[model samples]
Target chain A: MSLLDIQDLTIEAKQGQGRQAIVDRVSFAVPEQNIVALVGGSGSGKTTTGLAVMRLLSPGLNIVSGRIYFEGNDVVAMPEGELRRYRGKQMAMVFQEPLYAFNPVFRVGCQIEEVLQFHTDLTKGQRQQRVDALLRQVEIKDPGRVARSYPYQLSGGLRQRAMLAQAIAANPKLVIADEPTSNLDVTVQARILTLFKKLRDDLKLTVLIITHDLGLVRSLADQVVVLSSGRVVEEGPAGEVLQHPRHVYTQQLLEAAK
Target chain B: MSKDKHFVPSPGGLRNFRKNPWAVCCLIILGVFYAGAFLADFVSPYSYQNEDRSYSYCPPMEIQFLDEEGRLARPFVYGVTISFDEFHKRNYIIDKAEKYPLKFWMKGDTYQFLGLIPSSRHLFGVDAPGRLMIWGADARGRDLFSRIVYGGRVSLSIGLLGVAISFTIGLLVGGIAGYYGGRIDDVLMRICEMFMMIPGFYLLLALRAMVPADFNSVQVYFSIVVILSFIGWASLARIIRGMCLSIREREFVLAAKVMGLSDFRIIVRHILPHTLSYSIIAIMLSIPGYILAESALSLIGLGIQDPYASWGNLLSEAMGIIQINFSPWILLPGFFIFLAVMCFNVIGDALRDCLDPHFQVDENI
Candidate 1:
């Protein structure tokens, strides 16, 4: 069975007098131990869809009608208290900017430990060890130094890795990364992509990567869901979809990437 | 096994604060004043109520370190002979014939130390028949230096108590309003605006007027604190609310929300802490206002009554031209007020710089 099944999910953005659908009946799924790239240009509702999967849409945006199933439970219908149990433990998210994602005041290790504290019954010592282990899992050279430093103290690549460490700290089955590699340099981006593949290979982790980078999709995604405007234009295996474009928008996106 | 061995916790702002010389200086000055306030009974030679009417309008008696032969001697203060001037005003002339040597840890007035331990020993005092008025004597012949020390307890503490009360209310009201926007924000922000619309001084006066005439000095002190805090919190609430509104939108706050941290946890631990640097500066800046407000009320005979010293009530004796002209030492309380206010502002400015994220500490550390 698929780890996450998002079916007929319609999200609306409230503007002045009327509500406008930002994600129109968006349907997608991520199988176990797979990477699904929700590819789109700016304002294509891919990020909104990702946010909806976690029920974390920004204010004035509503899930008009949707059924977001994670393992069998409907995320859209789950009560707040129960949803909290699933978040950070069963499913986690990483944002586009690691510097902005991490609280500036707290040390990065404490932030990763915050996830472990809530999700696991680990003692402080164990959590500290776990934090170091998680950082090492993301290939951080010195977990101790990176953990001790604040968000701004680290390099961009290190911050991104720290953010990934925080996401996978609780051993969440799925990680929804919203444009995770867009902010990094080409070398760092490739390294982060490789880390994601490594995570899936070693931990059997599932990822729903929301990005506009077709190159990232080609290198990392097993499945591709092309979004144009607020609707999904094409959905297929990444190799088939990239090799033979079915939709005009997909063809145009491929043309633009070339 | 040694996971936290190399974990050096980040210095939030203390390193920057310590590097600031002016802030450190101000902090020391404040420390001295606060220590004096706390140890008033033990430090002051006389209690706040102790007075000798015979020594009225006495100027600051100079402590002599040399005898008539120009040889070194113990510090001593000469007795004052009371005489009437041409206008029948009491004039105190130094009686050089009679002198009393100063002694440290001398037993003078018995009082509760920290309102618990009863003790009579003072830091310094002169023998009976010669009073050591270091800052001079007021119209009531009360030691101005001792009164200032005792009054520091009230004037200094009121600032802290008032700020604590108001900021507690301000932070919670502002945090809740800012975090939970829409209807709650509208109601709270409108209430804050309504408070802001009223002139604070007039509101203070109105609140002061409401205090029953029968309340004792302690009751009056607390009532004034409540009044001052009530007037102070509205503006702080508004400012904190504005900060919260912006901070709630920051990506870190969003990330915290996604972590399934409860709204209260997010607001308190995450959102409120972001506003702390601003709040710290605001708190430091506002303390002076509380001190000045209490002084203003007491200056007009509305605050702490006579016999019970507060810096404000102590300055009340200087309202007359004659008092200001002849006994200028009565205005010494005003100088103390200025000193406290200036120190707080200097520290506030320094703290603002220290708390700034861009404020760079030394790289060698």
Candidate 2:
């Protein structure tokens, strides 16, 4: 089985007295140990599609029809209790806004440790050691000090790094990162993308990165799926599609990135 | 990093709390009152309900150091001589011819200290029974000062207890309503509105009127607390629900949910902390309402019945034109009521100011 697969996924939002399809019957898959970028512009259902893989769409939004299979189990049909266990342990997510992602009261290390505590039976000392190691893996200079710090205390680059650390703390097989580097400047964005690449290669983590930045897609993605207004215009291997674009929209997207 | 410049770390954890002068003053006053209340049995000269008929309507004893022979003596008080006013109310005259010396740490009343320790050597007492009444005597000859001290134990404690119960309900109900937000919200918020629709005092009176009047004062006090909590929690729940409505949608809460934390855990650990800054302020501000509620119930003879001195029941003596004209000291309890409410209001406001997240963190703060 593919590590993560989507088949005929259709999601809808409730408009006035009607249901409007946001993500139409589009299908894609992330093979084991590869990076897949869902590339699209504003209002293209990129983020919504990413959330559907985890079955975490907002309350009003509905998955009209779909099957999201992580490993052999259908994520769409899994019960809440089982889905909970499946999320933090088997598949984790990092969002675009790291500052808002963290609980403000707790220290960065404490938040990271909470995940380990819930998902694993690790002792306090073991969890602490894991948190320190993960922070360091994300290229934090001093994990000890940074762990004790709050999200507001860290700069934007460091905050994203902390978020990445949290996302991979459970050693998840897959990480669905939604617009992970959209908020950072060019230099910091490049560094974060590099960090993602290293972690993916080192841990063989299947990454489904959602972004509108095609420049990032060019360098990082193995397979690029182009979405426009909730429909996939082009889906192919990154080099083939990047060099010889098949769709007009893809051409415009690539042209705009330059 | 350059981020450090803008972040300007707080010097110490409680720096904001300690730096506010009004908060510290309120803290000290509340501490002193609560401490005095805790030690009421030890510090008070008489039991709360102990009445000496001979000292009825007696003026407060004047503390003097002189004996009859022009010699310095121990602290003593002149005996009271009773007379009649035009209104037929008994008037008291301090007769210097007879003096009763004050004794310190002397055995007076036999009662439970803090309802735990069994001993009663009061802080100070008159050498003879019925010789002194520091805040004068009420119509029933009970010492006003002693009753006020003892009343503080009941009034202050009931306010705190009621708040504890109310806040527990508010946090859970508000949290669930806001976190879940559908039929549950509708049901809960409507129930909350039902509570809000009733006038708090009438609800208090109605609920309290149902309890058997034969129960002892302790039971009555507890019933009052429960009723006050029932009335107080609705508005608090509504406020907390509104706060939670906005907070539940925060990215952090969604992040916690996405991480597969059980809903209860997310509400308790992840969501509640965001509402804490508001909850704490709400708690402080609401305490005075509880205190006032208890006092109002007692003032109407519906709460902490006679001889179980709460500030409200104590001031209930001044309810009539006759009592006010004859004995002004019956209103003495009102001063304590004002002081307690003012302390909570001031401290609550100060806490809100200091705890405001919008307040720019500076070196002084």
What are the lDDT scores of the predictions, listed in order? Answer: 0.90, 0.87
Best by lDDT: 1
What is candidate 1's TM-score against the reference?
0.89
Q: What DockQ class does candidate 1 belong to?
A: acceptable
- On a 0 to 100 scale, what is the lDDT of residue B244 in model 1? 92
lDDT of 1 by residue, A12-46 (tens): 98899988999998898899999999999999999
Report chain A TM-scores, every model: 0.98, 0.98
| Residue pairs in collision within model 1 | none
CAPRI verdict on model 2?
acceptable
Error (Å) of candidate 2 at residue B335 is: 1.4
Model 1: per-residue Cα lDDT at residue A202: 93
Question: What's the lDDT for candidate 1?
Answer: 0.90
DockQ of 1: 0.30
lDDT of 2 by residue, A1-258 (tens): 469888889999999899999999889888998899999899999999988887889988999898988997899898888989977788889999888899877899999999999998999999999999999999999999889999888888998999989889888999999999889999999999999999999998999999988889888999999999999989999998899999999999989988
The chain B TM-scores of all candidates, as shown, are: 0.93, 0.91
- What lDDT does candidate 2 reach at residue A252? 96
In model 1, which runs have C-alpha deviations exceeding 4 angstroms? A16-19, A119-123, B1-27, B83-88, B116-118, B212-216, B350-365
